[model samples]
Target: MTRSEATPLTIAYTATSAEPGVNIAALTDALTHHANSALFPGDGEVTLVVQGRAPVTFDLTPMRGDQIEADMHKKAEQINDQLNHMLAEVAAHSEILEASTNGLDVLGVYDQAIAATPQGGEIVMVTSGLSTTDPVDLDAAGDWQLNPSGFVAQINPRDIPDAQGRSITWTGLGQTSTSHAAGTTDPTSTRARPNSQQANKKLHTQHAPGPAARQALHDLWLNLCETSGASSCTIDDSLLPATPTTATNRVPVIEFDQVTTNCLGTFTLAADIAFSPNSADLTQAADKLLAPIADALATCPDGRRINAYGHTAEVPGSGDGIGLSTARATNVLARLQQLGAPRNTIGIPTGYGDTRPTVDNTPNGAYREDLARLNRTVELTITN
Candidate 1:
């Protein structure tokens, strides 16, 4: 299959002293997984925003891909190299300014990144999700109660541009760290103590938020992204595991028909192959159709739930239509779990049956096969 051109990508990253510092190595791993995930298009421009004392931007020219290759080999490598150099700069500067954090700088960076891409694009923010500076101080006492709606309301409208239907992803929230310098451990021997004790004391400290706090942060960002008119918002607080270099440039495996601003993803499967005739058993072709849906569900961040609803056409003589529909919904849920979707994130499956059809099954006393086909579907909605 011929591939279409990829949309441009913008990444905004910050590691400040107010919260735990970001692990550069882990970030590298995440970026590699992201780039290889095929979510980014080839021959697309890349914009990097590093938030330090201020927001610093780096806009790389588009890197064209080879037409003969199925994946973005040349483009991914070039983008990775360019981004790595920029991330190195962020790391070096972060070390120098470890005592202070300008968390508010991310708003300006978001504005700049969004304004730069008027047509549309994807924007990724990697930060602790805690802002210590003015405008919005998440770290301040009594601010923990701030919800997404309240947070967005307090922000200056002029500071953040409308997302214009762009995709926004916020990750690495609440991942904080600390580091201590080497110190003495011996009561005597004033010569700076033993090397072994000193070395162990200088370890890096990593801290993750409790489940409640993590959920609050996720909700705040998810709300902000949606309020900004983003087409979709994906917030995953967990640190991405290290992936092998061999997996760095693979094609994206998941695609959806549409993902609303509310993060509701709808996938209309092919009715002919969705299930066996008059039975709950899914056909082999249904596996291919549902695979991407499972992948999409897996990306949902914590504190959110996935609710799947099954709908079927109106079969006049079909006995137990509701039972069949419910059974199909249950099977779909089970298949999704088998396909790697988190069981905790999925809610109980629901069957709408023929009670709610997308189109008229028998318009003017004539059965419409096309209309009925459109009604056979499973809708997945994500909510906080």
Candidate 2:
């Protein structure tokens, strides 16, 4: 599953009080920090509403006397104290419970409690990240010059006090790299969840690239050879399909009938490479397939624009709605941008959902693969 829809991550909260000094906004910020700061944390989302009076909550309890501020300095300890306790309580009964909190009320009595909790789910605090107006860059590009200097990633979650009457504490780790390598302050030092390590490990397991991606790679290799002055090249087994779903799929490789080389020029090309699983991420084979294009762009005059549009078969319950084709197109565009393609020169991606099918949607065994192949094509157009 994509990180957004992954399990073990959820946030449901509402503020009981709506007082200004209590700074529901500030408390929200603190709680967001708590959620993101956890070790081996899953992707989290939060929704909050304010009720009659704001309620303070936390994991660990803070000292008896302390002042509350938006910065969450002294008060953070109190909130963290309460939050820890609440997490334990909720985890014990309802594995998951929607948590929330209010801060700086001057009342020492039991302040925080969890309600409407989910059964058999882990209890995790939720909050938002700091807000900033900065340009952010995605790191899939081989070279980094394509991105702007300043980029932003934001997190903001609501604050909640724990079961123990104290406010929760959270630490915001600012300035993380998209690569996710440990920043200046090492991530190992921070406390993490029990499943965090195992979870990350499972996430990294390898899988083979999907068929459309492999075919696109093969086509790119042949395209490059024909364009370049090469004596001869062989299509390796790695580039061919291991199993054939149809007659065409069984072909060893989409090898050129005859190699041709004459004139060399640079042109731009774009396509929406496909994958098996429901994800936009490109596999290594996909990258290899596109490498020739990148190489041509960098060196050959005929280097194409390489729009990198995405496409998918029209399937039921796939949310293949109106804008979905457009989304697939944009996803392709983004990949090209990330690959260091000249940003200004490339055209915006456009999708043709089953609109311009190369074959009938109806299945007819071997023939069905041809139509699907044609529909799944990443149409490449060359221009000066």
Candidate 3:
């Protein structure tokens, strides 16, 4: 969700025993390696609470980054610069002075950076990319001046661990221009899980997709140009899964109405199941919206199957929309199952995070959250 209940962005972590030295350079690489995750377009200092050391806060106010890779680098640079300066000051002046420079507030909060400290305090950085500070425009994050002397995309997931004892992996949901290219490493490379990451892993355990579910899902499609309440509908059937015969469904055919192109990517849900930005949990109102589809799946013929498609608006610090989207589709799929849709009939959960945006999310382009809501929808289709 855009606004969390509480807890803000504080992430509590537990590491087993002591390991190697604190890898700040690796940390910087992991945090800014990709445009996705651990940062929100929000405001505030990035408060990193190591196991035992004083809590370290990186003020992100004057520092501006819509959570983009480049901007994150800028922010990371700010952090690195401040830490170095503080450490240098502590070495020269004897004790680091409490201060705020380049939008960082570590001295006053963490006491002061000494020449060295006791070890064993591992790290876990957390961010909704959000903050109490003024909102940021993700589109504009890239426009900042770059430090030509140092802007490298060399850090791989190996540098960071995903806390789950696994790597930073991306289950493909049609990703484009993604960092997921055939890697120098595997999908299971070390990556940070933080708090939200733990929840993401649980979603995949719900159900395992098989040939039966995959085949049945082909029946669902948004091929209706005359869908109800559509503003402008022009969808390429080739781009979508094949449309199954609607005659078998007990409920009225679910048609789609296309919103303006600026709203989001090409595919909009005909049913309009609204999911908040970055949220996987469904609401009671969402249950109402999905009731019909579930009802249809309940009475389907043997081997009948349906598919749930999830989408997210392309936004900065949006993390791997894949996990978020997959979590969403799984949540909706679970509801459909609860409503009597058979497990086999439920195809795989697919999430199309910001990678596939119909609308341009450039600076000032995604100003309105309502407009982005269309992208955060789950559409249903019959496979067989």
After superposing candidate 1, which stretches have Cα over 4 Å from the reference? 1-5, 19-44, 52-104, 116-118, 141-148, 180-208, 240-384
Quantify all predictions' global Cα lDDT against the true fold: 0.54, 0.31, 0.34
State model 3's lDDT.
0.34
TM-score of each: 0.44, 0.28, 0.31
Error of 3 at 75 (Å): 47
Q: lDDT tens digits, residues 1-384, model 1?
A: 233434657666554432334444555654554444443334334455655333345433223453322446675666577667767775676543232232334455566667655445678777666554445455442333323455567777665569976888787666553332112233444444222234344322224443334444665667677777888888643454322110000111111222212234333443456788667888997776567657766776776666667777886676436777788778877887899888886777788888886556767777666456656666555566
Alpha-carbon RMSD of each model: 16.3, 24.4, 22.4
Q: Higher TM-score: candidate 1 or 2?
A: 1
Error of 1 at 42 (Å): 8.4
Model 1 / residue 167 / CA error / Å: 0.8
Clashing pairs in 1: 6-41, 20-176, 20-177
Cα-lDDT of candidate 1: 0.54
lDDT of 3 at 372: 51
lDDT by residue for model 3 (1-384), tens: 443311122222111011111223333433333213324443333344432345444433324444423465565666566445534443464211111121111111111111111121122321111101112211122211111001112223232212221111111111111121111123353542211123233211111112111111111111111111122222111111211111100111111111111111111242233454356867665655456556656766777666667766666665647777778878877887998767887788788776665434443553445335434555555655
The segments of candidate 2 whose C-alpha lies over 4 angstroms from its true place after superposition are: 1-276, 300-304, 308-310, 316-324, 363-374
**How many clashes in each structure?**
3, 72, 21
